[model samples]
Target: MKILVYNLKMNLDDTIYDLKKVTSKKIGVSERDFASFKIVKESIDARKKPHINIVYSVMVETDRKIRIPSKGDIRVLEDVLKKPFVYGSIKIRERPVVIGSGPAGLFASLILAQNGYKPLLLERGECVEKRTQIVNSFWAGGKLDEETNVQFGEGGAGTFSDGKLTTRINDKRSEMVLEEFYKSGAPEEILYKAKPHIGTDVLKKVVCNMRKRIIDLGGEVRFNAKVTDFLIKDGKIEGVKVNNYEEIHSQVVVLAIGHSARDTFEVLYNRGVKFVQKPFSIGVRIEHPQELINYAMYGDAAKHPRLGAADYQIFKKFSKRTVYSFCMCPGGVVVGAASEPETVLTNGMSEFARDRENANSALVVSVGPEDFENSHPLAGVEFQRRWERLAFQCGGRNYAAPVQRLGDFINGRVTRKLGSVKPSYTGKTEFSDLNYCLPPYVTDLLKKSIAFFDAKINGFGIEDAVLTGVETRTSSPVRILRDDNLEALDIRGLYPAGEGAGYAGGIVSAAVDGIRIAEKIMETYSNESL
Candidate 1:
């Protein structure tokens, strides 16, 4: 087999010219060679203005070496016959319970159901479609659905988010997740784009379709089934208490609780689960025109139909700390994702069509104990609480987000009136200074970052650009220790897995961790650990 790599340009007629070359280059080739051409893998460089590249391998009719290549990095097709390291089947019998129907739980249950394990899936929130309705009601009428809002619902926080599949991790399972999303009815374009997003509108349908498949395969998903307490007998997990009301029995339970389950963390801690505080990020969602980001990324190719809107991930080293964008949404809307009653928090979401008013992203900075006084496991929760409380007061005691203009934020003043741009938030937004919510250090650093961004992308720091208050729930602020057996540190059968457990960041990493923990359960605790 011969493998080839092609450098892709982010320009119009880029791929078309490549296809033309392919046709011209294989004039005398047999039909078998033409059929053998396939793009097995593609990736973009981890650099500014990165190029899209493809990897493939070819095999002639006379070749006899069919054995899988290993022990080194090679072309993707060279390992076609190899066993999938993630996601085919686990070959187990004991049905497991998965708490929270977010990405972690959904992927885990999907694989388990395919492997003949009827997973009992419990969700604290409503399904995505229903959850969206509840969310809209809260935004429109200020009537909040405490149980099924943006954070606690069927798809977890990501369900209400931009449906961004981008992550910093370079694990191989990332490709598997992207492929699985496509198979579950996401747009096929997500497979090849430099910055792919399923968007909130499309993600709802994808999640419902996936849940239907799980049910068809004997898996059970119980909505409004919030886990309130853990049942531990003889120092091992027996079941869980739901809604502080119903007790269910199960031996193997996967803790796929999304990061918004702060109450669950406190419950687990009081119930003898060991944990330690970890540093996380907190900041505001920065909004700019979609055309600004596209021009920054594509240069003159900004108007290219094939390219669409471009995305940027600007990172900087600030006094031994790093600051960057976390959930960049293009052609997106700033959403009110406040799960709490009075506290105002904001996030960004786009549509599959990406036909929205404004573009937004989390322009967050790293927060450490230097800001929070205590090293307690719940310190992160407190840090988030302080800002959310301030934002609550700033947002007129309702769940309205405290918004500021970039010009006003940099000038250390409050914005008085709206300019040419209108905020995308459905909830009311008051023009105010954001210094009250963010720490002095954070605001100072943000000023510098906005300037850097303006220099990088023209009109990035325009006066009309909106800055939504306090996107604090970037990730878990504590690590629930787990040993190689995938059980909680020194605990018998309790598996603290996924993003809420502080072992993963995004959907891909969380799903990979879930699979790894499930495999550990199958290998060590199965009735017959084959």
Candidate 2:
């Protein structure tokens, strides 16, 4: 019988040399009682501050009957094996096309390829290797490759992020996504950690390995292949026109274009694909000293090596809007994440070690269709562009981001000089009043939210903290309408998946949505037909 144990607590300084011995002792059994033990879940219990404890849920294989605790933490381990996916009988004439090589496209292609369906994965930007070099050059004062910057690459915008895999979703496919990532060079700890993240340094290798596996499984990947237009016949996707020249015909198309693909969204809207304006957030990247954040989160236990770096998520509600901290990167830097020319946006990223001197996050206010100037589906895009252009102008139209000190920003004054916390933006930064770019409501809420957040995490509103302008791309501005079968509404054979489709948020959810889309496609079309 396999017994599941929960709430097994250990001190940070305790050495976990043997799992079997530990499990047996916790369950009041001898070491020879359990045949094997596996950690089901691991999390840190730091609510008590300096007395932090490592909590574990373990599954133990034991033949002997053990006394189960009445604390409701232990129960019988139910091992339910999932049934295999049964392929459909409908025949497919051409290979299924997966647009964009981000998490959604990659996972969708992986699923199709593993089922013997050769999928053509298309990406507008370069692969991870070249994309990294291109992004580095752009950060180092070189020209930004509009087609292949931080947003359009093989791994999507997430490639240059902190690679956080945590999501507010509960799906079995989430495990599948994590498993695939683990198989593709991610650290093993990501499999069990409470909040797992594959830093930018390690994520590149993982994405590259996943791409290679897709290719090895009879899938074709093409870089710099931008889908300029959709070839439709009778409101059904017949193919896609690449770069406005080459047309690749395929009945089935997975529209996994990421959130930053504004042009693609416009093209789809013009092609009569149904869309609706959706809500997204916009704000600035706020930076603070890493030590400050650590001391705030860990209290007196800030120097514990077990707690590598501390991260935080905070939010507050207002009368008209809700302000929150999104994409908190511990010991990370603010980055220039511009895809369009002459526009400046800020994002945050961290390496695997997370040993940087500063921490940052997006302090944003919520915006919806009501906030947009018009009711048009693309209104949010225009709303974002307006502020991005304003930010560009504020920074002298030189691609430099506008930055301000927290004190000056709260006081409604332009920061002429930086303070204790320096800006870690990869690109150039110019001191400017953030009020010149952001909406009045947003700036007002941000000012108030900082004070509220400072109450939660001490020093959050430190005078020296840096605020980098214009983080508009928080999520998709529009949602491509889809039917019950995950196909585009009123358009057969067109599956709109991932963040671009507005069906998911973050990396894990996006990948899970992609897997679900692939499953729908497989259930509709037979792999043997290919």
Candidate 3:
């Protein structure tokens, strides 16, 4: 018999044995009666901070017949077993081509390869191993590798980010994705932790393992093979041109080019592919001492051994727009996430232990189609580029990021010197007026919202807290229009999937979307499609 219990609470000092004892008492059974037990979910109940508790949901399996408590939180476990996928009967002649090895493309190709559909995965950047070296060199004041830097790489932008796996979408495939991560060198805790994350350190290994598994299963992954052009014939995808020199023919193509693939978006738009300007956020990355953050969230019990680093999420509604914290990384550093030259974008990343000195998050404001006067589909792309370039100029035309003091930004004055909270940007940085890069409207709203957020999380708007300029790649600026079948509206066999196509946000949702697309292809086509 399998049983599940929710809302099981344990004190901060409780042990694993205490959890088993609680489970046995709740089910009116002896401790020895339990055969196996696993925590289905675990979350921190830090409402009172110092007296924090761990709330858990556990799945118990035992041979003994246990009494079901007549409470709402305890009951028989529901069947969350994934439904087996049924493949279509259509036959195909050529292998499918997946462009961009981000989470979306990786999962999509993994699914196809698992089902005997050999897929050719192409990434414009090098593998994670080589890509890491390139990114480090760039961070160390070396020339940025245009193709293999933080934004365009083997694992996509998320490779250099916090590697957060949390998403709001409630999908059964999410569990599958997490399980796969666990199987591919990720910590098993990610399978059951309430807010699971692999972090950049562990995530690199997991990504490499996933790639090896895909290749071992007969999928071919090629690095530095950028898809420059699509071979479209009468509204159907025929093949793709790589780096303007080589072409690979295929009836099916998965475009998971990521949110920073500006050039690819332009090429597709120029090729007459339909697109629409989408709303995205722009803002600066703010950093505070990790100890300050831990105290803010955990109070007197800050830095408790089991608690690790603390994180916060803040959202405020302004008259013209809403401000929110994006990609909040606890005990992390701000990274230079630029794909093109002469621009700077900020993102946050942490290691598996999250033992860094600072916490940072993107304080961004939402911008819609109305914000940019241009009605062109790619106008959002240009809007992002314009601000990015301005930020580049503000930072002395070098790779250094423009930064300001939170207090100075709110006071509408230029920052002149440093404070106790030093900036954690990986690349070089310069003190500058962030107002020079961001629009007046955005800066004004950020000032107001920072004040508001400070009330919620102490030290959020402190004078010494550092703010790094221009985090523009919050998401894709254009949506590659697709139909219910997940294919481009006018182009058959051309699937526009993932962030670059404006279909998903972050690593988990992108991977889930990728799995969904792959399933759709499997359900609609087979060997007979040829």
TM-scores, all candidates, are 0.89, 0.98, 0.98
**lDDT, model 1, position 302:** 62
lDDT comparison, 1 vs 2, better candidate: 2
Candidate 1 lDDT over residue span 143-252, tens digit each: 87778898888777788777888777877777877887898899886776556788888888888988998999889999989999999877778889998889888777
Give the winner by lDDT: 1 or 3: 3
* Candidates, ranked, lDDT: 2, 3, 1
Clash count (model 2, backbone only): 0
State the lDDT of candidate 3 residue by residue for 273-361, as single tens digits. Answer: 99999999999999999999999889988867989999888999977699999999998999998889998888999998899999999
Q: Candidate 3: misplaced stretches above 4 Å?
A: 78-84, 527-530
| Candidate 2 lDDT tens digits, 331-380 | 99999998998888989999988999999999999999999999999999
Candidate 2 overall lDDT versus native: 0.92
TM-score, structure 3 vs. true: 0.98
List the candidate 1 regions with Cα displacement exceeding 4 Å.
1-4, 8-11, 14-20, 23-32, 40-76, 80-94, 525-530
Name the TM-score of candidate 1.
0.89
